[model samples]
Target chain A: MQGVEQGVLDLDEDVNRYLDDSEVTVPETYEEPVTLRHLGTHTAGFESAIDPDVVADWDAIVPLETVLVDQMPPRVRPPGELVGYSNYGAALAGHIVAEAHDTTFEEYVQSEIFEPLNMTHSTFAQPVPDDSPGNIAAGHTRDGDGFQTVDTVYINMRPAGSMTATARDLAAFMRVHLGAGTVDNRRVLQTDTVRVMHDQHHVRHPAVTNWRYGFHEYGHPDAGVLGHSGATVHFSSHLVLVPASDVGIFVNYNSNSSEHPPPGTVIDEILAVCGLQSSSTEPTPTAQPGSRERAETVAGGYSLSSLPQSGPLQVIDVLEHVSVEPAAQNRLRTVTLAGNTRQWVETDPYVYHEVDGNDVLAFEVRDGEVERMYMASEPTGVYQPVPAHERQLVTGSILGVSLAGFGLSLAGWGRQCARQTWKQYRTETDSVTEGEHTE
Target chain B: MTDHSESIHSQQSGHPAEHIESDERTRSLTWLARVAGVTLSTVSLGFVLLLLVVIESGGELTLITRPFLMQVVLTLPYLIGFLTVGTTAGAVLAWWHRYWSRRVRIHHTLLAVLGLGFSWQLVRLGFITL
Candidate 1:
């Protein structure tokens, strides 16, 4: 086990080594040791290509580290760069695990993490077992007639979003964290380490004010919740624990709802099922105002004529358009939209800018509405509420990278075998010719 | 003594030529067989990779929203790679068989066509969002 841990760390180091030399710049070394906590929490400032989903075969195509090293460059944001979720951070953690054990990230997770956790149903490889107890839910989007399956994405970005575990097993793993890192008398993390894992790493997003090391922090600091939410094609899973209340809730839904349903829905439901509702008297507002407001501005739906008609038009699809987000004090922030999320400046009289040729369009509200709504020949568009199916596609792409990598590796091995055979035949033929000459 | 010398020289010379021609033919046939085998193997490997990709993708095609036509356009390179390699192997085998083997079977040609057909199917299935 110790050896495995070392291997995990080695992989992590390998990732860092690549990052250091790549265009993505980071400090040579941090004054403080960068722990798994930082990587899981998105404190590490690493950016990834938004289109990692288009890659069909990850392993046969490219290794995760190579892709990251070649494609990504570290552009550190202010310690808390909004609530910009970092897939790179999780990948770094996977790298750490690999480096520690002087082995591959996949092998380390299989031995140390998966084996001990008994997450037998889970794998980092794609095309998960067909005969597994439950069907691996297919991600679908309603086309004209019925739901059509979509291409899942591969994020050579491992560790962050490379895992594939069933809800039952993941819940059990969560229980260990709830138990402060000890499961079945086996300690996966020390109590203090677990606390560090749950400690708030960033407070950039008002929606999620506190982000613990690897999990999103919810509620007030004293009374809020702790845990991480995993989103992938048509599947959304959340595990929240109110350490104060000794309450833990694990929710997994197969539907593709883009609206991040109220954080406590599953937890609240579980509490009700258990006949315990501490805040039952407080009426639950079926309509959450914040999400509704954001939905109104961004979710009314708009079509981009310039976009290719094949897939859904994502925020990144409009890289040329200016995007603004509501920040503190009734002001909007100038943001660069990548996907559903944005990283913006939170200053007064907010300005939204998008790179147009060499110039930038700075958009602001002159009246009470978005000024110059339709700027260029590019049509003015609003956020179309993503159907449940589309949401699943987005989620699946995020989760599919690991599985894709595993599949690609098989193809690579096949090619290697063919080459080896050819080499052997050539060597044997040369030796035989030499013997004939001698005879 | 002269009769013995003449007999020995003629026998040795005739045997060497026959053996050289026979060995050349055998080598050619073996090369052809190897080429055919390798081509088939490559095609098989490609199909397997496709299955694995689909499976690993959780069998979802919706995630990749590019139109079927566009997908084909993008994946053209990979398909071409498979076809090029497979065809080269088949051609090599066919040449060997034609020169060295008694029976001029069109198996190599058929295998080449089959390999191309399989590649086409993969491209259609992978890129076309049907």
Candidate 2:
């Protein structure tokens, strides 16, 4: 918002112009240019670039530039082609914002967003500030025995999800969006610019609502809601704004678990209690007979579009499987790497809708085969089916060879042990006989 | 004549005794090498297998997420090194056994090779992490 207001950035301008060679080198495999608008709308065509270690240790916070360069997930499809949620792209935007301001991203957000809104309790610092206004909540994960407290994760892409804020501080920040970029007559963002930010930037699928600048659109326009949810290894947070009522709610959780109601659900429950229509009125489309064929063409294993296609880490392709399996009633079930299965109904020829949610998955078919798929979950556009070499077949071969090798080795060891014992016995018997002869 | 004959026979027996003792010492050292070589190779192979299983299991190694290749790049070196070292050790042990030991054992060499091979599958099964 600051960059747009200062005229340092043009939403339609190609983001590559602002990024220097040292900062970021977004590979351009296609003619389409990735603009600031694409990044904001989560249609940058980049896949999910996740490092499990990002927040594994808060002490090991890495430089943003390093993460940008090292974790640059491949752009598998052209920009503006699909809406795939990308933390990397969001962080890249933050980088661009910092570069425009001539300061660190953390420092810039602190001085700009935090200071302007008087969010004294909020800090973007990795490992978070020790002297913040409120007590930092500990995050947790459950194991076989019980829930275990997990340390706060600090990703190099801090701008994406590293901000630590108290409920009180968030309330102040929420007021700005609720108040149309101002609170108590203090302008954090110009009214016009906030209008543009709040406007529909991209529609993920026909059935679901569109994506605004930095927020996800939910529910009908009559009872619409704009919000964003974030989760680290330990903590989860959601900030929802109901523009009609001029009401905003901010919620935060100390622990992370599958058992916990997702922040979206909490927002819905809150809206219900407030007598608002929290349920989405998605227009379900008529089923196309060829929808099954189109879905089948795209139904296969898809590696992350954001991962390295070449080099050693390309092996991570296996860990990033997003299988699009066809289910009953022309619906598609997408089983993600984390083992979370989401049911998607075909709302259009090649578009899928999350059963009762706003999530969308759209596929691009060419020459009777699936060429690309853009998911609404995060900015990830998966292009090209996972090659045979990178699939489970290769893994099976490696396992088979390794097994054969181990079996042979173990058998050899057993035989050697028996031989050694037999030789020892023979040597002792020979020695005894020799002693008797000498006597 | 009897004294002379006994002396000659004693010297002949003494020469064979010296040769046998020398062979026994060489065989003892070779046996020790065989033991060290097989044991070290086996242990190395075990670790290599763990690394493989970890990669295959996507860091889980259980009935959870499908064991697709996890961070397999981090594991290749250990697997390759295990195989190379085990094979080299086997070759050296076989050569040593043939040249020095009175009783040649093929099991020592096979043990090394098989140990490394077993480790690869262990990795696929996800019992370990690299």
Q: Best lDDT goes to which candidate?
A: 2
Per-residue C-alpha lDDT of model 2 across residues A1-439, encoded as one tens digit per residue: 7788888989998888888644687788778888899888777877654442354455567878778887787776688876666788888888888777778899998888888888888888877666766777777665566776654556677687678788888888888887888877777898898889888888654434568898876544335778788776566777888877888887777765354877767777888789775454454864567766666777887765655444334445565677788888777888866677988877778877778765667776778877667665543334447765455556656645555555566677689789999999999999999999999
Error of 1 at A51 (Å): 4.4
Off by over 4 Å in 1: A1-38, A48-61, A73-82, A129-135, A143-155, A205-208, A219-222, A259-439, B1-130
Worst 10 residues of 2 chain A by lDDT: A308-317
Error of 2 at A205 (Å): 4.5
RMSD of each: 19.7, 9.1
* lDDT assessment of candidate 2: 0.67
Compute the lDDT of residue A402 as modeled in candidate 2: 51
Our model 2 lands, by Cα RMSD against the true structure, at 9.1
Q: Write the per-residue lDDT of candidate 2 for residues B23-71, one digit (tens) a residue.
A: 8976776666555555555555555565557644333211111233334
Interface RMSD of each: 12.6, 8.0
- Using Cα atoms, each model's DockQ against the true complex is 0.04, 0.09
> DockQ (C-alpha) of model 2?
0.09
